[model samples]
Target: MAGTGGSNPSSAAAAPKILLAKPALVTAAKYNRGPGGGGGPDDSNRSRLPSVAFLNLLSDSWDFHTDRFLPFLTDNTDFTVVGVIGPPGVGKSTIMNEIYGFDATSSGMLPPFAIESAETKSLAKHCTVGIEPRITSERIILLDTQPVFSPSVLADMIRSDGSSTISVFGNESLPAELAHELMSIQLGVLLTSICHIVLVVSEGVHDNNMWRLMATVDLLKHNLPDPSSLSLSHPQSSDKEIKDKIQEAGEEYMASPVFVHTKLHERDSAPGYHVQVKKALNQYFSSTSFNKPSVDGGSDPTPLDLYFIPCKSNSEYQYESYYSSFWKLRDQVLSMSGPSFSRTVSERDWLKNSGKIWELVKGSSTISDYCRTLQNSGLFKR
Candidate 1:
């Protein structure tokens, strides 16, 4: 259902509205911390906690079960996975921290994120390297991923001519940075496959690169292979053929994309700032088809559930700074009783899906294929 949170400044009789949170929660925690485990410097005992584990790098391959929660997933609990993506330093983590019920100022109690007091502050660096899974309850799972467009990650994105703005590699061989970013995008696609909702947060306004990033996401989703139909027995099916099937099957009911415009100055001089953002986003998505192609066929226009949260700046009470608005957003999330998609995968299925997609990423001939696909599809066109 479309939300009533947005309104025109010129509309005089606007009713007070409560914005519904996308039917799930999105949050992130430190990779080293375990559920109910202390956030001490020592992670030597991490093996004991299966629920919170780190993802493997190229040097090390991750067995999905090793991240733990495999056994818990088998218990048949209906869990909602919420994935949060945003540009670096946009307060994605901090906003998620608050939504997960973490109050930075509270001393005696542990924050839901379980990070130490010192680690709570925002930093320019990519705090999350890979997918950091945090389980708030048996029914809730939050996947906090690396910030999109972080210099560390974008430095990996090579040009069409096989040259990056920054030289991570001296030769034409696929740079490790490109491979790594590809892996991250694959993870985001995997999350979309299983997540109940995907929350995309951005600071200020949307830019060309931001739109292109989202466009690539649309392509990936349209091309993502169906988990059930894919098997080791059928190794002959090409990626394009698989993608065709995915497109034919039609778009899976996904967590509706909720665009959050954060860090607003809340100035009296800018009373219409929120409305202006809503207007721009409405026009952008309407004109762009929300980054999906019309060749895929059209569905009814999906409501843009955009919400604005005031800038907290460097305040210690960042969560409290917009506590009232936060509460309303929080209530909407908690109250989401939306029915699950018929295509929703169970936890074990999610692991298998992850493994399958990871193999696809590794098997692809070149990372440049993604860039070309996005470009040819006109996803990044202004």
Candidate 2:
């Protein structure tokens, strides 16, 4: 549901929005604040997480995550597992490996996946996953339904006597005539454990690609019920009155999603493009559900929930920046190969976009001063 706080943009005619909030939160580096990704004993990663400071911080792995809630998932929640599903070669494995540490790699170091195990089996030796039905505090399961988008994989899974449940991944990619069956089966890869949606746009967006993404969003919106009409399903829902208001305004708290033309690889104006895409989505929501103004005079619209799940090729993920950050982090931690090339993401943009942290640095006279002040001004006190 959308927020009713002034923090949210006024949107009766428009859909209120919220930030995903992960990008802003900062924490001390786990490996002695070193460039390495060592498994450290530092509490900073979890307990000392800094408050919201950046826009894309929501994409950070540990940020906004709740390990305490892990115990609540046992036989007590509607969401039991995160079913990672996506088209073949779409970096489903890569994304999951990065976020969840599944030991998936382009390197054939890990054995080819096993398809005939009746029970959950280990995809790697590091973790004994999917071996039994038993659920421990480590009960958060990451199920991998076969790639249903491909006809051959579907046939293989169906023919197998092992796991029989079929998860339709990206069934929207299927024919329009197969919508019903597809919708029922195709699983959105990030089902559980709150996987952030990283919409990797294809390398290039021709006119047709834009139409495809737009059409996909339109289809999903049409099939799902509006939050306004439904009772709050989140068991740990926040303040009671806020819950009521959110449900009341959920219908109106929408996004404006414009078909952005920029390449996902470009960094200079990505924020501008993100805002435009959001606008297009919000407008469509407004047209369908006209949420009434809050009589209580409160506002807290959050648009960050509107995920732009891109249906495109694997071009964006192959870009240098994503590869550098992910792979370099991987090498630093796992002692893998490091590529010989430039790797410099402007800390300025990320710093500036972080509202909480940026405010402190905004008045600085130089980068060194800003860095020092930022480092000293209690960036994580909140």
Go through the candidates in order and give the C-alpha RMSD of each one to the true structure.
11.5, 20.9
Q: Tell me how candidate 2 scores on lDDT.
A: 0.27
Clashing pairs in 1: none
Error of 2 at 308 (Å): 9.2
Please name the candidate that would achieve the greatest lDDT relative to the true structure. Answer: 1
lDDT, candidates in the order shown: 0.49, 0.27
- Model 1, position 51, has a per-residue lDDT of 33
Instruction: State, as a TM-score between 0 and 1, how close model 1 is to the true structure.
Output: 0.64
- After superposing candidate 2 on the true structure, give the runs of residues whose Cα lies further than 4 Å from its correct spot: 1-80, 102-139, 145-270, 281-300, 305-320, 323-382
Q: Which residues of candidate 1, in runs, are more than 4 Å off?
A: 1-69, 103-124, 152-172, 175-188, 206-209, 226-248, 252-254, 268-271, 287-300, 313-321, 336-344, 361-368, 372-382
